[model samples]
Target: MQRLFNDCIYRIKALGPEDSTKLFLSRAFGSTNGSCPMELEDAMKKVLKKCGGLPLAIVSIGSLLASYNSPESKHMWERVFKSIGSEMESHPTLEGMRQIVIISYDHLPHHLKACMMYLSIFPEDYVIVKERLLMRWIAEGLVAEKRGLTSMEVAEAYFNELVSRSMIDRAADIVNYYDGREETCRVHDMMLEVMVAKSLEANFISLIGGQYEVMPYDRVRRLSIHGGVEASKQSSFKKTAAGRGRRKNINAMNVEHVRSLSVFELEGHKLLNQLGEFTLLRVLDLEDCKVIGKKHMAHVCRMYLLRFLNLRGTTITVLPRELGDLEHLQALDVRLTFLEGLPETVTALENLECLQYSNKKDYISDGPSKTA
Candidate 1:
């Protein structure tokens, strides 16, 4: 792989400052008509110098500048140049790149902002499976139902828009799955840092990690355990209630406010039972968790508000019949588990949109009779 990367580098030619500047301006303003605008020439030169002919830097900066959409005006271009002056002058590091990327995020349509911010739930460099992410989005009610289009289709369009804008990239290793051609997306690390910051600010997704204290605003709406690290994140959260000189009442933490929770490789049975308190929960994803038995997931069915439930790659051999109690459930993923058969009540999920199990086969039903 290293040799291939090195060989690929050897085959490429570096873009000169002139071409680099032209590319950035053209991408930003849509078209420069084969010439740079005299009114904005000085500001463009400054931006190009900071970008240093680096493709990623250029794209990031171009996206920021494009937000202005009036590159023909001297003041508009100068304002953008001034906004990035501090970071650009400092150095071409990830922090500098982050400033540029953030501008693009801020300019996204209001509806897409939450969708983009949700990407922070996954750890850095995490390969996000397309079908799983979209299904999760649909379950969260992030994609608004539109006329003549299913929420799944709208979610796919959102994913593609992010890809087109270079916010996320398609993962190289593709796996064939039941949904579609196996594809995944990944966000850059620098941008991931900005996303984490934004998510925390909006209180969109509360991320628990090492030595963190629960503030008044910490009441989780959507929670992601193990932000990047695996074992440490869980342990940190577990100790949060005990560590700080803060209140010890677990009830004070308001677990009920959490609408979505994703845990990876969970080995604690205690935590699994605690999920029962989150009655308002909509999405509970325990993929790859090491839950001991069906008892661990007993509370899940009682979550009447639940729209999505994922128990993939767990040790469970049987699903509780109470799962039918999730009347509002839309997506249920029990893939890669030892469970042999689904409960009869599973057909009771009239609103269920996607059901993924062990085999690479899709089971669609209009009602129980059609399935029969």
Candidate 2:
């Protein structure tokens, strides 16, 4: 195999000590060169040695230590160094690198940990929109209110911190034109692997479609269905006798405890009809889903605890007049849909803080308008 594709192959080697140290410092302290205070130099050296000149290990360990880079936090730095156990020495390959990344995850703050694990809900290589993600986080109660900061502000800080730590990467060339701020991000593949593993271990989320087709054994908490061509094929096949059994199994799954449900493709639109089953749901994100019409809004109106509802890019014509019954609704996004207009009942939503919509002329509403 190597002989046949020798010309196409490129052998990438690990970074040298000098370059590794530079990368580590750049990530740890945002320094151009490998520079640190005298108090932290010893601790940094001890941790860098274990990285074995590998870029991934260095970045992971460096970002983990960034929070403890102050002179007063010398003991914390030493503690981090000691925590990189003997497994790193025993397995000095990809396993060791995974261990390094897991260490970084292990050191995240409790709220940040929940937020990070939520990234696993997205499909592999999916570009996540910052505003959409923050709204969901807020609806899921993952973002705690600070003394002076709004919940959205706190969630933004959580996102920036994750970017700073290299847990998620800011998408290049994808800036919001209005504010010139980062609007999209993608999780690193390795970091995403860690997140998915951790999410499953804790039963934090239940996934369907995509690479994961089996139903989870535990009660659903947060559900994400990533549909694609395969799911479309499976949906068609469900018309057969064998497929009917599978469909029944899916319909029987409990969703009463689910707080958030996000479906990414048109194939999963059938699940939207069962919204009545998600009694405690707070977020219902069905971005870009097609074939769904105003008939489904009946189930949506029944969700009294819903805080965020996204039907962007769907084929819905209008919302139900009973939409006002969702007293806890805080945000509603219908951008890029075929909706003619919002119902007058929308005005009755005292808690609605964000009402995003677009008209036939493609005129988008400004962000967070309560009066809409």
Candidate 3:
């Protein structure tokens, strides 16, 4: 592979001071050329110096400062400068860039912090759908209800803010030409690392797959399952004494308090069979898991506290008749699934606001629903 790809490979060099300044100013003040007011020039120089000529660090810190009103606010500039630890300058490595990203995360508003950390639930390089993420945020109560704006509108604003801050990257290949909005996004690997660290520190989420295979001994509040059945099985048990000891099962971990659960593996149907343990779950995202079928849907119907249920791209042909039991359900996404029609019991969900499906044939035509 190396011999075949040698001619195609190219290394991106770090930006020099002048180019770094231009990039920083463009993100911070929307300047066509790199220019700053005289009063804040010193602080800007110091901030840029800490960025170490890395474009990612420059843009992240620049966009973070942009949130504060007035570029002329030397106090705000100095405040941000102070928030970045002196250790970053001493290190001057990729670790320094990671610190810069963490600083930006630290500056996010409380509500956005929760939403941002929640992004850690997704696997690295995962293409996150905007509407789906917003629904999850709303379900988790991460987005506050504004006086005139719906929860979704509030969530949209949050997503836009995160994008503007360069905390999340828009999926360049996916766009809605009619609306001129990017439909998907992905977190930069570095940013995801910072989010994962923060999520682990706060115990805000527990992940099972990839690099996060060890389950925390504490109560699992929000769980995200990644990888396939084998990965799940591996994460569910731990071996001791040079792999000769009896396997210890993680089923003893308390799960009744888990409020949200997301499964990204195709064989997540096995996990769904245990849904009854998570009685207080508010969000259940099993998107693109094709192995899920009617049997799993039966368990899903029993999640009485569920507010958001995303079964998009599953193989389930029919929703259970008891779907209406989830009176608190706010969003139900069955798009790209084998389901021909929603159960009539869906009409009984009084709080249902967003019902997303792939085809008109899936709708009953008697209630308010949002189609994909």
Once fitted onto the true fold, the runs of candidate 3 whose alpha carbons sit more than 4 angstroms away are 1-12, 69-72, 85-91, 173-182, 229-250, 359-372
lDDT ranking, high to low: 2, 3, 1
Give the alpha-carbon lDDT of every model. Answer: 0.69, 0.77, 0.77
Q: Best candidate per lDDT, number?
A: 2
Over 227-334, each residue of candidate 3 has an lDDT whose tens digit, in order, gives: 553344453344222122211323545777899988875534456667777789999988777778666777788889999999876677888889999999999988
Off by over 4 Å in 2: 1-13, 85-92, 173-182, 229-249, 360-372
In model 3, pairs of residues that clash are none
**Candidate with better lDDT, 1 vs 2:** 2
lDDT of 2 by residue, 1-372 (tens): 011232475333577778978999998898956579998888888887877777778888888778877898989888777877655543456566777888899888898999999999888777777888898889888998889998889989999999888887877534333334437888877788889889988999887766666767458888887656444555455535333443564587887688888886554656777877878889888877776766678888888999999987677888889999999998998876777888899999998888888742354433431110
Instruction: Evaluate residue 294 in candidate 1 and report its C-alpha lDDT on the 0 to 100 scale.
Output: 58
Model 1 ranges off by over 4 Å: 1-44, 52-54, 64-79, 176-180, 210-218, 227-252, 267-270, 359-372
